[model samples]
Target: MADVRKHMIFHGRVQGVGFRYTAKYLARSMNLTGWVKNEYDGTVVMEVQGREAMIFELMKGLNRNQFIQIDWIDTEEKETETESSFEVKY
Candidate 1:
């Protein structure tokens, strides 16, 4: 399958709630490569690159978090990058 990249911006109570850490962990477990960072506008932005199924699974994993309330997600399909690992960007 051709790898895909998704650029997502998650809104709601995402920051200061371990969202980035959880995303990083889930991405590593699923062997997805990308980076996640907290936006200045109280949102979280992430770019996940992997198979379609794995990327969806990562989203599901993120939604399962109790403290992180994802009110909305703005997603865009982008050209894939040669990222080797997922990281929590500061």
Candidate 2:
């Protein structure tokens, strides 16, 4: 199956925290491919692409815990791509 990509923007106190690192770990463990970066406006933006079920699982897992303060999770479907593995943005 082709990889489905999603552009996600996480709002709230997401910066200066370990949200990015944790997200990277989660994505890696889930075997998803994408990049996660912190926005200047204290928002965390990410481009995640992977299997449908794994993607949904990762998103749900992210929403479950209270590690990061998630005010809102705005996501949009994007174009598909061939992703090798997940990673964290510098």
Evaluated with TM-score, which candidate comes out highest?
1
Return the top candidate by lDDT: 1
- lDDT for each residue of candidate 1 in 1-90, tens digit (9 for 90 to 100): 999999999999999999999999999999999999998999999999999999999989988999999999999999999878999998
> At residue 79, what lDDT does model 1 achieve?
97
Write one digit per residue (lDDT tens) for candidate 2, span 1-89: 77789999999877877888877888999888899998778889999988889888987777766777888899999997777877878
The positional error of residue 45 in candidate 2, measured at the CA in angstroms, is: 0.5
Sliding window of 10 residues with minimal summed lDDT for model 1 = 56-65
Taking all chains together, each candidate's TM-score versus the true structure is: 0.97, 0.86
Q: What lDDT does each candidate get?
A: 0.94, 0.85
All models, RMSD in angstroms:
0.6, 1.6
Q: Which pairs, if any, clash in model 1? A: none
